[model samples]
Target: MLYREAGQFKTSYAKDQAVFPIIQDRWFIALVLVVAYGVVPLVANEYWLQAVLIPFLIFALAAIGLNLLTGYAGQLSLGTGAFMAVGAYATYKITTVFPEINILVVFVMSGFVAAGVGIVFGLPSLRIKGFYLAVATLAAQFFILWLFNKVGWFYNDNPSGTITAPPRTVFGIMVAGPRATAEVRYFISLTFLVIFALLAKNLVRGRIGRSWMAIRDMDVAAEIIGIRPLQTKLLAFAISSFYCGVAGALYVFAYLGSAETEAFDLLQVSFPVLFMIIIGGLGSILGSILGAAFIILMPIFLTNAPALFNLPMPTDLSKHIEEIILGGLIVFLLIVEPKGFARLWQIAKEKLRRWPFPY
Candidate 1:
């Protein structure tokens, strides 16, 4: 298993502590990267790649951002949606203002903006922890969404209060707005996702990540061990926000083409992201991707199930069944494993590695 270092030799502490010491894990990751960055893009259908896969990647990136704060750092955040909006609007403004500027650059710029706002809201965590901190984050969720909706300038003077995606290209290739092709968008999204996810994985394994995990397990002990709670928490917020920002930019540029403030409402944006982290397994990057995929695909698969099989359409019945199934899955996962879906995955992988062996 990637998390284990069995039958491998380490001459020093550094080698022992390497992120992936086992040959099996290294090969497994190599194979995965090959499939993700190679095969999937080469052969996937446009509809599957665009509508479903791209959105799943975006949400997974967002979930990884949330996981860093809540799962690793032991702080709660309910306002990722708000931070994402900052990414969206800030990107919208920057791109529109500088028509000649590169669209890809806007993605990084949005992250910087969202990171600033994320830190401002994250400041409250210095004094509060647990539920109180989560409540404070909720204030941000509503306030920021409202701020954008009320401000006409943020919407670029659109009558419907939604910001429309302007047509843009990179290297003369269409990659933004409606005219962009699915394969083009998929590769772009995958490029960033792979880069950032690797960065996040490295972060958690490094000094910063250890500090967060220490803080999560026991703040008092971590403080005694010289981990600066305030400094570390703020860093987590900033970096976490950075990931959310990029994800937000992708949503508009690659997926939505245009977005409304309503896209980030508390019930729609905030809660679903929260559920993804919860269901995906907190503190695990791979879990975030898996969780986002499961949640995103559930409703889609449900709606299409009847049509896919040519079964009688029950309309309301299918919708209700989906709601029940979603709710039940969350409840069952929580009661069964409060640590989130990541833990279950850890167990599964361990079992796979230990197959044909006894405890």
Candidate 2:
């Protein structure tokens, strides 16, 4: 009943086309933002801030990026981790060389660097697609990691071959490095996710997003309709990589602090993000957030559930069981709800809208 929009009337195009046209949705989004910005920081413990929240936000951002490319643009990519590595390494280099610059600017610059790399790698999308395109991106995953591993210049010729986030301050508060508090890092990550998610949500409703979707649906038909495949596909890759690059920077500076190339390996970064969109729902921004939260929380729950239930499960067996369960859940969800959680949420909302009497 509360979901009713009976009195809400839009007399203007902007009002009618608003992201949350329904007053109820606008209020709900506002409440969510208030809780996220105002309440979470005040009550969350260090462990929650560091282990769960920060990583969840970062992964959500990455999933959004991948969702834009793979889900929206119909370009299959397996090089997500590689792009993240590009962002991390780019941030390291930028901060090292120009410590005087703002950290926010450095993050944006790192995203551009990753965008350039993404464009270069995304070139093959014009020539190939589907499994072959995925294979090409997979090659990128291996090649980029290999390049980072072998290049002494990337890690500042350090024998460790590891990239570490230099101490950085935002508005006089340390948000990166060993001295940074978990709360500050969480704030930074949360801010980035909020901004990016809003931008992505709006962007998907605009012309460029429509072009990408058209290409995704049918490239030949899109071309017949005046959508340039090259520009559209490359632009998708560039924007997607930019989002991913920022996510990678957050992963390092705001979350991990220090990491090696192995941290962004295909299995660790790539597959998980792909799984996120697949499980979250393709072509849906809300799905990206839900998917990230699901992926991030599931493992933690699996590990902790045994102790909570006082079950005597060995560590090795527990890990195996976790793997089996995750795999089974993915398959089951695919069978039951192919569009993932976002679609289910949409259906529930429709039901609510038609409540009290069956049509």
Candidate 3:
């Protein structure tokens, strides 16, 4: 069989201890990266790139952050929307105040704001669990959004109840606001996604990851085993929010160029991202990306399907079909694989490993 690995052998410890022991898996990941960063831009039109791909990428990034907390660390959060807002508003202020800084710096610095807010909201997680902790996050959502709304200074006297991202240039190329090109933002978002994803992969595979997983599986057991519950939980919150912050910065500076109250609504946070991670898989980063893409593009396709096929779907019925598809996909995924897309991915990899050698 062309895909057989029966004869493969590892000699050195380092070679045997690698993340992907199989050569095919390593090549598969490399192929995916090449297609995502290289081949995609060549074929996709601006509408596809901006409307579908960008949203999918950024939201997947946010979902990955949330997955780290809710899925891995066992902290239930309903305030992901609030953390995203903190990032958006923080980016607005940083860029406007200096007006000379690199856009990359703003993306990174905005994480601090989200980190602070995440910590504050995370305080209640120590005392509460399940629905009570969820309620705590709800409080954070309302309070943080209110602070940004009523506080006129946060709006920068723009009189729009929003922040307009100024023109941003990366390495002397315009990459923000209306004048920015789709390709520029695509690359920027792609770069940040890659960097942070690598960091998260490392973090989750290391000691901190062990602690989070322990806490997730059972807090009491984790505590008895010497995992400090408070510190581990707080670190999850901080890192998770930091991911959201960078996503928020990109939302304004790269994609939208302006954001308002609706940008970080609970529905925006809980549904798109929360659902993405849940449907994709709780603990797998690849599942986050797959879920984000599936969630982001499905509705758009539903809306545009009629036009593409020359079929007449009433506007209202089209909307209903969109909802139906979403609901059905969730139900289908739940039924097909209770463990989620990650579990399916595992099954596929195993099948690849045992190709042409079925028991």
Candidate 4:
């Protein structure tokens, strides 16, 4: 009954087109924001902020980036980690060269750098697609990582060959580097995620989004109807990389604080993010967050479940079990609900609205 929207009448086109048409949804979202910005920071300690929430937000942003391309635009990319590397390296270069600039601006500019590289790699999509396209992006993954590793300039010629985020402040508050507390890092990441997520939500609802979807659903038909495939597809690549680039910056600066090329490896970064969108739901924004949370928290739960139950499971054994369970869950979701968790959430809401009567 609480979820019912029976009397929330839309008197205008804007009301009808609102992001959250149901008053309940709007209130729920507001409450979530309140908790994220207000309560979480006040109560959460280093462990909660560092181990779970930070990574969850970062991966959610990355998953959203992948979904924009693979889900909405019907393009396959295996170079997400590469784009992220570009962002990280680009941000490092900019920060070192101009020490006085705001870190947030540097993050945005790094995304643009990654977007340029994405456009270059994305040219292959114009001619080839599906498995072939995946192969092309996979090559990008290897090549970009190699370039970063071999080039002394990217790492600033540090003997360790790893990049570290220099101390940075936002409005006099430390938010990056070792001196920045977990709470500060959490807030900065949360702010970026909220802003980018809103931007993505609006973008996917507007003309450009429609064009991408047109190409995704049926490129030949979309072109026939005047949607230029070249422009739409390239735009998707650019925007997707931009988001990934920002995510990469946050991953290093806000979460990890320091990282090397191995930090953005294919298995560690790319595949997991790809799985996030797949398990969460393609073409759905909420799915990205849900997927990231699930992926990030599942292992933690697995690691702790044995202790909670007083079982004598070894750590290595439990890790292997976690992998098995994750793979199984993916297969199960594929077989039973290919639309993924977001669809399940929508179905539940629909059912609640019609409770006490058969549809």
The digit string of per-residue lDDT tens for model 4 on 1-359 reads 76798888999999999988899999999999999999998898889999999999999999999999999999999899999999998999999999899999999999999999999999999999898999999999999999999999999999999999999998999878899999888888898888988888999999999999999999999999999888899999999999999999999999999999999999999999998998899998899989898889988888888889999987789889988988998898889989888899999998888886745
The collision pairs in model 4 are none
Q: Per-residue lDDT of 43-129 in model 3, one digit per residue for the tens?
A: 999998889888877888898899899888978888888899899999889888988989788889998889988987898888888
- Model 4 TM-score, 2 decimals: 0.98
Best by lDDT: 2
- Top candidate on TM-score is 2
lDDT of each: 0.87, 0.94, 0.87, 0.92
- Model 2 deviation from the true structure expressed as Cα RMSD, one decimal place: 0.9
If candidate 1 were superposed on the true structure by all CA atoms, what would the RMSD be? 2.3
| lDDT by residue for model 2 (4-26), tens | 77778899999999998999999
Task: Judging by lDDT, tell me the better candidate of 3 and 4.
Answer: 4
State candidate 1's TM-score: 0.92
What residue pairs clash in candidate 3, if any at all?
none
Off by over 4 Å in 3: 1-5
Candidate 1: tens digits of C-alpha lDDT, residues 1-359: 34445767888998877667777778888998899888998878888997799998888888889989988898988898898888999899999899888889888988999999998999999999999999999999889999999998987887988877788999999988888898888888888888888899999998999999999999999999999999999999998899888898888788888888778777776788888888888888888888888889988998898898998867999889888988998899889998777788778878877665635
Each model's RMSD to truth, in Å? 2.3, 0.9, 1.5, 1.2
